[model samples]
Target: MPHVTATKAMPVPASKAWEFVSNWGGTDKWIPGVGPVVVEGSGIGSLRSADLAPETGFPGRISERLETFDLHKMSFSYCVVGDNPIPITNYLARMSVKAISKDSCEVTWESTWDTELDEAELVVAFNGLYNLALDNVEQLMLSENQ
Candidate 1:
């Protein structure tokens, strides 16, 4: 299994961070590489399809299902289902926000997947993707507060 984890300090309350990240369907608004996302249903078991931006060099859409949603914990887990553009399978990703202060929180995103590529290669790719997404989240959240 190849895994990648990235974290960033978000200048927002944990609840606010959770409210945005946990909305599975709202990913396109913050994830820089994702195009419009279409989601079906709500809450646990909902499915989300994310289309990758052509500029990212990875074309195609990936569908994932919400596995666990814990608002009180400010965390969620989603597993990739089908139409994955990445060269990996059995992908399970988790995202969470932990409060650092009354109006500050740390967000962490991690994932584990089985890939045909070597572990090092897969890790490098996923790391870049996760870091970019986390940076986007931080920037988007901060700008919204200004």
Candidate 2:
């Protein structure tokens, strides 16, 4: 199993950050070249499919299912379903936000997956993606708060 985690501090309230991150269907807004997310069902157990933009150089569609959701806890768990472009299987990920202060928050994204490929390589790749996404979120939240 390969596991990776990425955490970033955002200059925004936890509530504001959570509202952005918890939108299971709105990932395209902050995940860079990912967009056109289509979701089925709702809440926990809902399924979402996202298409990676062709220019991203890593184009493919990813499907995921919400395994758990807790608005009160500002956290959620999801599992990748069906075929994945990434060379991994049984992928499970969790995301959470914690308040560092009234004006700031910390967000963490972590995942574990089974992979036959190089674990270290995958860890770095996943970490990069998570961190980039978090960075995008932070920028958007700050702009909104201004």
Candidate 3:
């Protein structure tokens, strides 16, 4: 199994960040080139699907299932379900936010998956995606506060 973790600092409180992150269906707001997400249920066990925007270079849809959610803890875990464009299987990932100060927080995304393909390449791709999404989150949150 290959594991990858990406973390970024945000100029917002953990609670503020969690408020945005907890909206599982609102991922498109912070994922650079993802279209609106369609959710099939509410809370844990629900499924969300979205198509990557053409400009993203990954022109395909992805479905993910919410595995665990904790509002108070500011954390959640999800797994890729159904068909995946990435050549990986058993993809499970978690996202969490931790307070760094009264006005700042750190966001971390980590995942482990099995793949027969080039692990290094996939790791780099996943890390890039995570960092990009986190960067988007920071920008959106900062703009919202300003």
Candidate 4:
């Protein structure tokens, strides 16, 4: 599967930002392929489960189990729950959030899936998601900041 990556900055404290993005269930609001999250345990090793929604090319649900995570490192990793497309399922996607200031943080999304998912197609989908998520977040931050 081809990797999809996008980065965005938010004017919020690192702790606050971490709390928002690190929550598995919280992803539905921003991520395109994710819905609600079910988490168990605690810390990075905590079990995170979520349903991947249908996108442009496909319309089905896929479950992912977050296998690794690190709050201090601002990174997390996950793998597909079931047998999926040979090329699309066998890979990992990681996301990291870094703080640039007390009120500014940047999130970097990266994945290394093994596939030939037309780079352009993946990019187009990701771009829409990234822009939508970022814009929504910025608005949220501004409203909260006020």
Candidate 5:
């Protein structure tokens, strides 16, 4: 299994960050290139499908299922269930937010997946994707505060 991790510190409280990221269905609000996400059910076991914008060059839909959700811990884990846009298998990702200070927090997003492609190649691609998403999160949070 190959893994990729992207971490970023955002100028937002942990509670505020959790309130947004843990929503699961609200990914489009912060995840760049992702369109509206449609979700079924609520909390753990919820299923979600989101489409990638055509301009992002990865135009397609991907579906995922929430596997673990922890509110107090400000973390969640999910598995890709169908229409995987990425070239990987047995994909599982965990995202968590940790309080850094009274007004800031760190978010870590990590994923492990099996792929036939060269590990180095996949890592670079996944790293870019995850980092872009994390960057968007910071931008969104800051903009909201302004």
Candidate 6:
């Protein structure tokens, strides 16, 4: 599993940041390549969906798909459903939040991707996506603060 983790100091309150990222569908707003995460059920076995990278113009988005969704846990673990757009064979994204202080919070986005891509190639791609999401969250929180 190719993995990447990113952390940023959000301007919004820890609870505020947790509310946004804890929702599965909200990922697209912060994570660059993420589409709207679709959820059907409620937990462990809940169904979810998204467009893979090929469906979009970006290469990384190809692995996006509806897998399992868990709202109560504030995290999502999914696999490639089928007919994804990218070269990824197996992929899983798990996002979590941790409070550091009254107004400070940390959101950790971790993903494992198995693709035809070489380790070096996937590393660069994963890093870019992770950083983009971190920057997006930072921007969103900052705007909310003001």
The 0-to-1 C-alpha lDDT of every candidate, in the order given, reads: 0.87, 0.91, 0.90, 0.67, 0.88, 0.65
- TM-scores for candidates 1 onward, in order: 0.93, 0.94, 0.94, 0.75, 0.92, 0.74
Q: Write the per-residue lDDT of candidate 2 for residues 22-139, one digit (tens) a residue.
A: 9999899988789789999998899999988777656899999999998899999999999887788999999999999998999999999999988998888788889999999999
Which one wins on TM-score?
2
Q: Report the lDDT tens digits of candidate 1 across residue range 38-135.
A: 99998899999988877776788989999998888889999999768888889999999999999999999999999777889778878888888888
Q: Compared with the true structure, what per-residue lDDT tens digits does model 5 show for residues 8-102?
A: 99889999888877888889887778899999998788899999887766688989999998888889999999767667789999999999998
lDDT of 4 by residue, 8-88 (tens): 888777777677667775666766566676766665545555555555345455556777788788888876656552236
Off by over 4 Å in 4: 39-56, 83-87
lDDT (10s digit) by residue, model 6, range 68-143: 4445454555565556665666677766666677777777777777877587787777777777877888788788
Tell me the spans in candidate 5 whose CA falls farther than 4 Å from its real position: 55-57
TM-score of 1: 0.93
Give the number of the best model, judged by lDDT. 2
Could you tell me which residue pairs clash in candidate 2? none
Model 2: worst 10 consecutive residues (lDDT sum): 50-59
Q: Stretches of candidate 6 above 4 Å error?
A: 33-38, 52-76
lDDT of 2: 0.91
The parts of candidate 2 lying over 4 Å away from their true place are 55-57
lDDT of 1: 0.87
Please report the TM-score between candidate 2 and the true structure: 0.94
Residue 113 CA error for candidate 4 (Å)? Answer: 1.2
lDDT of 3 by residue, 21-79 (tens): 77889999988778889999988999999998777666789899999998878899999
TM-score of 5: 0.92
